[model samples]
Target: MVVVNVYAPNIYTNRRRLWDKFLSLCNSIEGIWLIIGDFNEVRVPEDRWNSVFDNNNALHFNNFIGAAGLLEYPMLGRKYTFLSGDGKKLSKIDRALVCSDFMTKWPNTSLRALERNISDHSPLILSSGASNYGPTPFRFFNSWIEIPGMVEAVNRGLNKQGNENFKDLLLG
Candidate 1:
């Protein structure tokens, strides 16, 4: 599993750069990917209320998501994630987006909004609601071999005693 936390800049140019960076990086990910963040942009006009709408920004944001093959589970408990200081404006700027690999691995994933306190932004919770099935078999990815000292780590694990420690070493 791979997790990415982002804080996209408010400016479109900077945000576009971030998107470009992520787009370039996305193809290399072979496992489940979850991206959660304050993106500072909306996917559509409906995502914002009482705020200036930017069609260009929204178009680019949607394009990025589509091009990257990212999926967003519908937000629950709230329609918006950000509120203006005066409480007049609302926008769904924060979200959790996953790759298809993630959805395939955890089909029950969900995104939920939590109550906002002092901050103008409300917190988001991403849940898979998966039940434990005891010990799962360990599966190694080819990418792990590229990491420094991974072979040494595996060798050390191979020498370790007991099934519990060995199982936990790889996937716990």
Candidate 2:
């Protein structure tokens, strides 16, 4: 797996150049890849609030994602990841993009935004879902008997097993 962190420039020409160069690099690579960081750009109008929107810049940014065959996962916990000092302007600029191979390998990939205490940008977290611990243990709640099929389902399930303790506890 390859991870490439990028801090894109605010200048249109410079960011475009960077995108072209990065596209070339991706073409030559042969493995799962994850690219993330402050892209200094947004993919849609909804990504910005109380700020000017540039359709051309968004087009270029999305073109870069398409040309690189990068997949952007849905962000969780927040709508915007950046805020101005005045707390008036907000934008969702930081993101995580993965190649198809990486998405295939880690289908449960997700992105979340953390609190932005001091910095202008919120910290972004990318993870591949939960870690496996073990099988779940069974526990019965008395309140569950209020449900329609609770008693019958329990009786059917209990009948399939030979655990006398469970049978006694359930019956009592």
Candidate 3:
């Protein structure tokens, strides 16, 4: 079985090329195609936190995903995957798509959204081995706020921030 977790950053600007690439890349792969990752696109208005904004890219993304004949795993509970840093906007950009053949063969496969920690984006976890499961509890730590320059770093940009070695921070 082929399990995939792809992150397509800036998908809004490269919809055409990205969709073409996705099709070409998946065409060669065999077995189960479980594509899970942040797509940065919403299938509908209900999928986005800010529907008033013109999101032509999101519409284009939906068309491409439908043409690929993939199954969009129905999201349970939490409707949005991203939150605006200021709490004004939210959207469901993260998703899991599986091919019909894969679903038929592995009926047990499931996907769900995980909680956010340091970043505005929520983590998505997919499990093909489990037959059934429910949402997992997320733990929060106030200590994270005590980290030096943590707030400043977040303001600068979460992705561009210098390596903080989170594992080391926790273990030290």
Candidate 4:
């Protein structure tokens, strides 16, 4: 797989130019492609919180993603990857986008947002391996409680007896 890590410019004009370049580059490549990094932009208004949404910017971003034929990989462990210093603004600016071929090769690939302790952005962990890795560490995110059936899911997980059984349940 071809993995491209990019840090896009904050300026809209510069970002547009860069996106064009990326499109050209993607066009020239063949095979699985994985694009990961801080895009400095959001595809939709829902991606940002406590901030003014820019419809124009969102349109540009969404167009780029569609043109690139990229799929936004589902993320776990956090609703947003970026947090302002004052903790007022939140957005998911960092993400992983994979082509369909890449998804076929690594069907179990996942992206996990690690704790953001020092930096403004959380570290993203990408795991593409198919090997069994025992039980996944149970992490309770307060935001998850808001989701319907999440509480029931947790209870069912906790109800499983024995370490092996619980591990198997989690892995399943």
TM-scores, all candidates, are 0.74, 0.76, 0.65, 0.74
The CA root-mean-square deviation of candidate 2, after full C-alpha superposition on the true structure, stands at 6.9
Cα lDDT over the full model 4: 0.86
Task: Give residue 98's error in model 4 in angstroms.
Answer: 0.9
Per-residue lDDT for 34-137 in model 3, tens only? 77787767777787665564467766776777777778777664678888888889988888888898778867766677777878988776666644354444
Off by over 4 Å in 4: 132-172
lDDT of 2 by residue, 24-75 (tens): 9889978788999999999999999999999999999999899999999999
Q: What TM-score number comes out for model 3?
A: 0.65
Name the lDDT of candidate 2.
0.88
> Which run of 10 residues does model 4 get worst, by summed lDDT?
163-172
lDDT of 4 by residue, 1-172 (tens): 6889979998988888888888888899887888899998888888899998888888888888899999988899998999988999999899999898888888888999999998999999999867977667666679989999888877776666766644535533
What tens-digit string does per-residue lDDT give for candidate 1 at 78-99? 8999999889999999999998
Error of model 1, residue 2, in angstroms? 1.9
Candidate 3: the clashing residue pairs are 49-90
- The candidate with the higher lDDT, 2 or 3, is 2
Query: Model 4 reaches what TM-score against the true structure?
Result: 0.74
Q: How many backbone clashes does candidate 4 have?
A: 0
lDDT of 2 at 31: 79
